[model samples]
Target: MTSFLERARSDIGTAPIAALNVGARRFSAHRDHAVEAFPAMDDMRDRAREIRLHTLANLDRYLAQFADTLEAAGGDVFFAADAREANDYVVQLARARGVQHIVKSKSMLTEELRLNDALEAEGMEVVETDLGELIVQLAKDRPSHIIAPVLHKTRFEVGALFEEKLGVPYTDDPIELNSIARRHLRPLFLTADMGISGVNVAVAQTGSICIVTNEGNGRLTTTAPRIHVAMLGAERLVPSIGDMSVILEVLARSATGQKLSVYTNVLTGPRRPGEPDGPDELHVVIVDNGRSKVLEGQGSEILACIRCGACLNVCPVYRTVGGHAYGSTYPGPVGSVLTPALFDLDEWSDLPYASTLCGACLEVCPVRIDIPRLLLGQRRLSVQTRTGPMWMRRPLRAYASAATHPRRFRALLRIGAAIGRLFRSGWILRLPWRGAAWTQGRDLQTPAKSFHRRWKGRNRGS
Candidate 1:
C-alpha cells in the first residue's frame, strides 16, 4: 500500500534524471519494438533454457567446483542457506573490517530479501550505485520493474521527485540530468568502504564473477572499495566462462536490445600482487535461500529465468497494473510464479491469480520458461486448498457442475436465458447486483439458448 519502499532518501540526491533516463530507455525501447523487435533472438531462449536445466541438474557438482575454484583464486567463498544468514555473514565481515560506507550495483536477489534495509537497520550506510536503483532508493520507491527499477516514472515525475526529495534544481533534459547524477555520485563511489554487486554469472571453472551494466558504476563499485562482496542466488552459477558467453550473448539483446552492456566486467578474485586496480579482498556469498527448494519442485522452471525483463515488456497485465500491484520485490509474470514458490504461497495467493493466464512471459523468456503453466499450477494448488476466496470457489463449482452434467445443465441454462430475455429490449440487456452489474454497464445479450440445446435441436431437426 505504501507508494514507495523504505530505503534511504539521501541515496538519490540531485540526480532525479538518472531515474528518468534508465526508466525512459526501458519503456521507450519496449514501446517501439518489443514482441516484434527480438524475432532473431527467439532461439536463444531455447538455448538458455537447456543450459539452465543442465546446470541445475548438476547443481551440487557445479557449486562445489565454483567454490573450490574461488578459494583457489584467493577469494573467500561462503554459502548461506537463506537471506538472513547471508546478510549476517556480510555484515559481520564488514564490521570486522571496520567498514562503514557501502556501494552496490543493481541486484534483484538483495531486493527480494530486502538486504539493503537489513544492512541499513544495522546502521550501515549502504548506497545503490545503479542509476535506476539509486533514483528509487532516493525516492524511497520499490522497484516497479526488476531490470529497470524506475521504469514507471516519467521524466517530469522524476524531475519533480528529484526536486522534492534531493533538493536539486528541477530539470528534464536528459544530458543535463545525467551530468547531475554523475557529479553527485562521483564522490560516493570513490569514498565507499566496500562495494557489493550481483553476479550475472559465476564461472565454476575459472572462479570468475561476471557483471553486465550500461553505466560504469558496477566497475567502480567492485574495484574502488578495499573489500568487495558479491552475493548471488545459487542458481546463477554456470559450468564455465564458455557457458557464460552463451548467456551474455542473449542477456543484453533479449533485455535491452543491445549486443552488450557498456560495462561487462569479469573479476576473478582479490587484487593480484601486481594488479593496479581491484579490491584487496574479494568475498563471494552463495545464498541458497529457497532456490535449492525451487530447483527440486515443479515450479523449478522459474530457476531457469535469466531475468531479461522481456516478459514484463510484453505482458499486457504487467503493463496495465504495473509491478506494484503484484506486491512483491520480484513482480510481473516471473514474480507471479517465483515469489510464491520461493516464499509462502499463502502470503502471495493473490499474486498467482493476478495474471490473465497470458503466455507473453513465456514468449519473451530468454530461457523459454513456461511461466503461464507455473502460474496456473500455483492457482490450482491455491484453489484446491481454498487459499483463494469463497466467492470464486462457490460460483466455479456451480459452473463446473452445469457444464459437466448435460441435460440438467442445459435445462437450467435455458431457464436462465428465458428469464434474461425479459430484460432484452431488442437483445439489449439494459437492466439496472449479481447480473445487473454486467447488464447495467454494457450490452449483455443472453445467449440464444445453451449451445448444447441448439446442437440437440439442430440434430433432431426441431
Candidate 2:
C-alpha cells in the first residue's frame, strides 16, 4: 500500500482546486462575519477552553453523571470500549428491533467505526441524509473534508454523479440537485426504523445530546425514526448548559462563520409521553476507542477539540492536498496529532511531520487546543522511541553534532557551498543518501555563501 504522503501526492491532482478556492473564500467571509457578530468571541473561546479542560479533568464524574441523568430520563446508555463493541451493540439492537432501514445524519464517529458497512453486512439499508454525506455516499467516495464532505467536488461533477448513480437528468443547478436528493431521502426519513447521529456536545447537566447542523436532517434523523442512537466520543462532554452555550457561540463562527447552525437539536431523551414528535426509543453510546488512552498521556489536550474544522480550513497542507490526503477519518492538523496518539505511533509516524508548525490551527481552534504543541510532542516521542524512518536517524544525528560546534558547522557550510559551486544552475536536483528523498520533488537552492560568513564579512566592513 502507498504511504499517506504518497497517497496525498496522488490525490492532489484529483482534488478540485477551483472548488476548494471558492470554499476557502466563503469560509473566510463567514469567519469574518462571525467575528463581527460576536464581540465577546475571545472571552467565549477562553470560557469554552476552561470548561473543556475542567470536564476532561473530571471526565469520569461527568460521564457517570451524564449516564445516570440520561437513564433517569428513560434513555438507555451504553458504554462501548472500542469500535467493535460499539458496532456489535448497535447491530444487536437493530436485529432485536427488526430494523430494516437506518437514516443517518452526518456523523464522523460512525464513519470512524465504519458503522454503515457493519450494518450493511447484517443486511440493513443505510441512507445518509446530510447533503454532503449523501453526495459522497451515492458516489461511493469517502468524505474529503469534515464539515464539507464533498468540498473537493464541483457542481458539474455532482450533477454527473447524480445522473450516473441516481439516474437523474444532468444539471449543475444547485436547487434542482437539492430537490432531487430531497425527493429521494424524504421517504427514507419517514420509513427508516432507526436513526444514527454523532453528538457535537453532550451536556452532563441535562443529559442532553446537542447536535448542530445547517440542514433539518439532524432533527429529522432523530425525530422521524422510531429508534434514535447518538454516538459520542467520551470527551464530547460539557459540564453545564452555560459551558455548552459558550462553546456553541464559537463553534459556528469557527466552523462555517454562521452565528449558529440553522438547526441545533438538544434531545434529552426519547419522546416524552406528551411530546408531539420524537423517537419512541433513544440510545446514547459513549465510545472510548482509545480516547481514554489519549487522556492518560501528554496529548490529552487534543480531546478538547470541538471538531469545528477550522484547523482543516486554515492548514496549508490540508488545503493543498485535501482531506482524503490525510488517509484518516479526522483529517488536517487535528488528525495529524490524534491519529498517531490514538492509533499506532509507528504506523502514523509520518503524520506528525505533515505540518509546518504554523500555529494557525491553534489560533483558529474554538476551544483553544494547542495542536502544534501536541504535534511537536508527537515528533519528539517518535525520535525518542526511534519509531520514525531509520534513514532519518543518521542525518539528524550528524546535523545535531555539527550544530552544537561552531567550527564544525562553519566547515560543513563551506563544504556545502563548494558542492553548490559544482552545480551549474545553483540548484541541487538530487542529493546523496537520505537527502535524495527530500529532493525528489524539491530543488535545493545552494547559496553562494553561508549566512554566518556573510554576517561576519558585513560586520568587518562596517
Candidate models: Cα lDDT each = 0.80, 0.90
Which structure among the candidates has the greatest TM-score?
2
Candidate 2 Cα lDDT to native: 0.90
* TM-score for each predicted model, relative to the true structure: 0.87, 0.92
Candidate 2: segments with Cα more than 4 A from true spot: 15-18, 390-394, 397-411, 420-452, 455-462
- Tell me the lDDT of candidate 1: 0.80
Q: Residues 1-462, candidate 2, lDDT per residue (tens digit)?
A: 456778776766454755774686578668867887888998888988999999999999999999999999999999999999999999999999999999999999999899999999999999999999999998888887779998888989999999999898999999999998999899889999999999999999899999999988999999999999999999999989988988889989999998889999898989999899999999999999999999999999999999888888888888777787778898889999998988899988888988989998888888889999999899899999998755466789999999999999989887877777699797889999968966988998877775877799889957
Clashing pairs in 1: 45-366
